[model samples]
Target: MAISAPLNTALRAFAMLLFVVAIAACSRTPNAMPTGVGNLGPGGGAPGSQQEFLVSVGDRVFFETDSSNLTPTAMATLDKQAAWLNQYSNYRIMIEGHADERGTREYNIALGARRASIVVNYLTSKGVNGQRITSQSFGKERPVAICNDISCWSQNRRAVTVVQ
Candidate 1:
């Protein structure tokens, strides 16, 4: 059976109203938490959470396999983060580089070093003082997540931004 235009229009309006009400009922602000930073995996962070890290004393950030390039998306993400770092010049930032479990320890260390240096270089270009930023290589020593798939690999491959 075909519905009349008026009834169909009313039904759609009611459905839209329910959705808006449901979303409004569910929305709430999250409580702030201290940045354990890399001590805790990314879980440690809530969406939109900003945690400060000191680059001194060795910050731990990881990278992907044999690559020093930050992905375009990573660069965009880092740009906002770098802006924050630049805001607080007193705080030092150490970007720690890490690799996956598949490589030799030494090889991973070199790759991790490259990853951290790349971040430092980018930060320098962005007007962040080189003296305020430094880097270290954890190589494959730390794994935020460990699994045989890309999901696990992605977390393991990171450069942590530490502030002190």
Candidate 2:
């Protein structure tokens, strides 16, 4: 369903708040911020190791329908990521929460937050340090596409686990 304009506005505002907070969280070096926020890939990896954090093998997780609770699939994904993090103890990460463009904007933003936190909690439970994982919700702001179809909407409802 298309979102109501009021809800959309609220969600946009929440997303803006989250964007600002995320920017501030990674504001250590002026140069480091862009690498993390703009390029969700391996932009911050060591030289010649740009592909290090590209979510290769198992680095992120996708959620089921409208729930923030992780399914077995998501659990498995995080288990792999947890193992990866354990293998590389010094690695840090940023869990970006996103929502598909199918619900009220504010509600979607809240759902996104819950989803990201779920992943964060799962990782921490599996031995990854909580401090190293920062969660942010983008609601439906920066969609990869603007289509209203279910195909596009399903893809939009996701939480991307990017390395820092």
Candidate 3:
């Protein structure tokens, strides 16, 4: 027996729908944020992924223009990060400092390093082990937003926490 053209199209569409459903079903909890403490709790998977860390504990802290100092807002966010770090002692974090596109490459690198160091010091003061944290500067090399305006530059001047 030969299938009709319309039946063949319908079957193909049905198979595609089934594939999509299977993928959706395989997904874990939609609202589940990575606790930063490996999935050793319930799920049998590798340690919490960086994406999860970004979702659960804020991964980036913004800074003012041309400054390495932490603002009150930044400090608040870091406080939360420090608490999370303390709770998940098994995880080590690398803080990355980034600058906007306004300075010479060498200057920007030094500035970025200063920004990252500030964060490390802050976290250390909050009781997070200094040994568990390290910092690097990407300077203006990596930017989250690209534009000549302060608005865009503001987005790029930041310190990001990465789990290792």
lDDT of each: 0.72, 0.76, 0.87
In candidate 2, what are the lDDT values of residues 9-121, reduced to their tens digit?
99999999999999998866555444432454344444323255453435556666687878788787888778777777776788888888777899889988998999999
- Model 1, range 122-153, lDDT digits (tens) per residue? 87888888888778989889888888988888
- Stronger candidate by TM-score (2 vs 3): 3
Order of candidates by TM-score, top first?
Answer: 3, 2, 1
The local distance difference test score of model 1 is 0.72
Residue runs of model 2 more than 4 Å from their true location after superposition: 1-50, 53-55
For each predicted model, how many residue pairs clash, with residues at least 3 apart or on different chains? 17, 0, 0
Evaluation by lDDT, superior candidate among 1 and 3: 3
Better of 1 and 2 by lDDT: 2
The TM-scores, one per candidate, come to 0.63, 0.65, 0.70
Winning candidate number (lDDT):
3
Judging by TM-score against the true structure, name the best candidate. 3
lDDT of 3 by residue, 89-140 (tens): 9889999999999989999999999999999999999999999999999999
Per-residue lDDT for 124 in model 2? 96
